[model samples]
Target: MSTAVRRRRALTGRGAGALLAGLLLVIAANLLAAPILLYVALLLFLLVLFAVLVVHIPRRSGPVTRRISTDLLTVGEESQVAVRFDLRALRIPHGIWHDQLPPAVSGDATGEFPTDNGTSIRYAITGVRRGVWAVGPLTLHTIDPFGFAQRQQEFGETRTVTVVPEVVPLAPLSSNIGAAGGTAHTSSTRLGQGSDNLSPRFYVSGDSMRRIHWRATAHRGDLMVRQEEEESSPDALVVLDRTARRWERQGPTADVAFETAVSACASVALHLVQEGYGVDVLDSAGTVLGRLRGHEDDRDGLLVALAMVRPQGEARDIVSLFDGTPPGPLVLITGHLDEEDAALLRHGGASAPILLMTDPLPGAAEAAARLGWSSAPLRDDIGAAWEDALPARMATGGGHVQR
Candidate 1:
């Protein structure tokens, strides 16, 4: 119990005992039969009456119950935190209630209800920021009928809620090949043919029958075959820097950068997924966040996983992570960048497009220029940068074709 509550209990006990003692004295004085005894009895009776009238009086009190619908939510979104107060056998004329909200939720209104009888009250809270929020030990205070004493009750369980960042869209930018006065030609090392299928096209004059599409010939009126073409559309691999040092602060400075990275990755992944391109996301610790396998239903799971992403103690070295032969088009998002990191990416064998996203570093533009990479500064408008870095025509009907 709190010190204040213990003190109040002690005061109430003493006052009750004193009132009882005065009543007993008055009863004994009535039996004395002498005038002085009678006068003394009347005086003691008056004193007891005064004590009861001025000090001891019924106070308001009852049990309070609260229930939170969810312990996790997203920023800038409203989650229903149901608060229920149960009052029983307590005649509370009027009382004000204040719910202790976490610092992240910056607002004055939580839930306040006045009651004269045993009843239940409910209210909702809307969280507006990210991080863990605590819903607290409710406090209730009331003044006694005589106004000489006050009673307070505290109840409800402490809860924690985690709020994640929000996701937005990105803008469009020109491709490096297009800017270099060379028509962009889509080429891939993967063995494949016409857009998707990997089977070879049928023989023309000396064409081999093995290359013919028997299924297509049966469906179509004429003979049809697959074409042997190198995989043109390269996969997009997104890498997010989630090292402990990256998200060192809990305030707007570091937190905003972390959120921006998450938002950018999510937006780009979703956009690419919708555009019929395979997408893979990797965190700083070399953990694959998501690898969509031509399945759109898995998008929700990806988002939920991202929502729970927290900085870990694992130290991530960007240079070593992508050291050897690289995969497809790589997009690296980080809060810090160095010369060695730039060199590692440039020599990382990422022949496909390489996009670097990081906080505004001292030599960001210069490093990007050296590596022949298009740089996007981390800002409130990072979503725009993400969109701009993507290929111009990345839709279902259109394919990255060679000129």
Candidate 2:
């Protein structure tokens, strides 16, 4: 049979008073007449003490296991964690179970359960922040059948849960410019392009008939197919502005500009990938999130990276980062743009598309005209601007206009 051991505080009130009276009576009998009365009183006191000890020892219950609804959840979503207690070893008259959750989860309260073979308790909480949260080490407390003593047991095993930011489908920004206009320079050395044949040269020993440019060969004396120039694919680099000066002026609540920028970048990247283009991301701190590789489903990785991003002290010059490469389209996403940055972008060797995201700058229109790029204010009505800025072909998939 199962056994329980308990340590309780000394008795008080009626019990203490009765014990004192019995002791006094015993002492009085010993001092006066009746030795028999003294022996009887001592026996009664010893029996009462043994009975109290027997009632104090509490019975032990079986172990418990806890399970949560999901190991990963999104912010603003509810988490339901259920704890199951096994009581086959000993019958529990009453018990209390408390599950400890991370501070990010709120609205949790202590729960009580009546004695039974099996007890399941549930806790409901809502995740308010984005990050990883751990839940476990449920504390179990039990009082003796007689309610004179209590015991506590802590289960150490724990589980980890990740809470990600809620993803809302933002209407594409009106001021989004296609990163496609720039000069394409050719190199002396020619490498094989991914495109199919344009024309064939003089039949080499191993040349195939399929590459023979028939139309050109008909006009020329020597056998020739359409000679195709090797085309270089445009590289899509997303530049995110993260300077402290840009975000520090916002109110106590987190600045929505950063969130808007991140969402815009993510949305654009997804669209570009679907259009068979290479995409890369560059932050103000010089950290690169993605490389100019073929598109894949990397939305989760990108969002998580954005979640931990914070404003930094150092500033990044857009021109320096784009120096020395062939002219290709560049996309800049920022809250504010200074004259130096604007001049560099406008005069930069490559044709650039600047997406200026600001909350109502004093001279936004003048700055945009001087830089020769489109500009749109950041606001709830931004959808119209995004629609206008997006290349008509991109919306219709006809073909992208060269900048």
Candidate 3:
């Protein structure tokens, strides 16, 4: 509860008119020497004063509570906000109320305060942008019974709602992806092994002597066991190049192109996870932003991470994100790809890799194609890039082979 009360009082239209009239009457009384006119002026002045005092009197208000319908909100989605406060602390007056909303939110925040039915009010708001938005400081506007004066009082603290990027649906990975040497349908061979299919792996603490592969151990000169890990899932990677030089910034968030890239990254990762692939979301500097391992995992966490991602870091070669290993279902979301950058990325082993660019400089697309990368210009229709790259991956040979 806040003991501090901030109040603003002002005269209504009628009160202003009355004060003007009282001034005129006082002038007339001085000119005409009529005591009757002076009496009328004094009454008018007192009435205006009384109205002001009625509205400005200090009054204590009870604590206010606010509640939101959902824990998180997605862009363009609506959420309900409910407010409750005590009405008995002061003599209620007929007035209107408004809830202050940030620019990122859209909705009607004003309504009649102290409804005849109850002491609570509810309003709906739609998230217009991605980020944390504060919606609060309910303000009550009261008018005197005679409508001569008005008062405004703000109550309660601010509450925040997180809005995440919209995740659009993406087409399934092309069937030819696996044939082109992508591990989209299977786990990375070097990372883990399947229980149903026996494979060699380093011995763990609980490994049984019966499951040891002595021949493999002797060949590798290290103890190996046939990993029976049932929890292992196929891995995929979504590399987001947010280097500041590559994107345009509008403010704290990147421009529309970067927003599209973020959404594309989210959609691609979600699609892969639904298709039974463990997805790792990485930035341009080889930093892992978020990871989704199982189909049943909570995806909101990943979306929240992407919601806060902005254009940062200096320009660097994206090849570092591969970490010298053959990546699976590789999707690189970048901006302003040039020939020199394309040439440097050719060394990685991502068979039929998908390159989604916001702005592809002249000759950049050609170089990417020459490196066996399926390239597409990113746009509002996210699936267009997916569809365009699918056919190219289907026709090309795997692993940096020229088309």
**Quick one: ranking by TM-score, best first?**
3, 1, 2
Error of 3 at 321 (Å): 2.2
Better of 2 and 3 by lDDT: 3
Candidate 1, residues 1-403: lDDT per residue as tens digits? 1212322441244445555665565666666644565565456445545544443355334555556565556556665655556655345544556666765654343344565454455556665655565666666655444333445566666667666556664432234324321123222344552356555344477666767888767777556677755554445566777776655565443476777777777776665555445666878787878875456555655666677676675545544555354544567776666655554445255434545455645766556547655455677786556544443422212333222
Model 1 spans with C-alpha error above 4 angstroms = 1-72, 109-111, 116-124, 172-235, 244-254, 290-329, 346-358, 391-403
In order of appearance, the predictions have TM-scores of 0.58, 0.54, 0.80
lDDT of each: 0.56, 0.56, 0.75
Off by over 4 Å in 3: 1-9, 58-60, 115-118, 179-231, 252-254, 295-298, 391-403
Query: After superposition, which runs of candidate 2 have C-alpha atoms over 4 Å from their true positions?
Result: 1-98, 103-127, 136-154, 170-234, 249-253, 292-297, 322-330, 336-360, 379-403
How high is the lDDT of residue 186 in model 1? 24
RMSD of 3: 7.5
Q: Candidate 3's error at 182, in angstroms?
A: 9.7
Quote the lDDT for 11 in model 1.
Answer: 28
Tell me the TM-score of model 2. Answer: 0.54
Encode model 3's per-residue lDDT on 25-132: one tens digit a residue. 999999999989999999999989887777778473656788989777887799998888665445656778788887777888888776442378889989777877
lDDT of 2 by residue, 278-368 (tens): 5557786668765543533365666566656666766666556644552233555666655544454442544435454654356654565
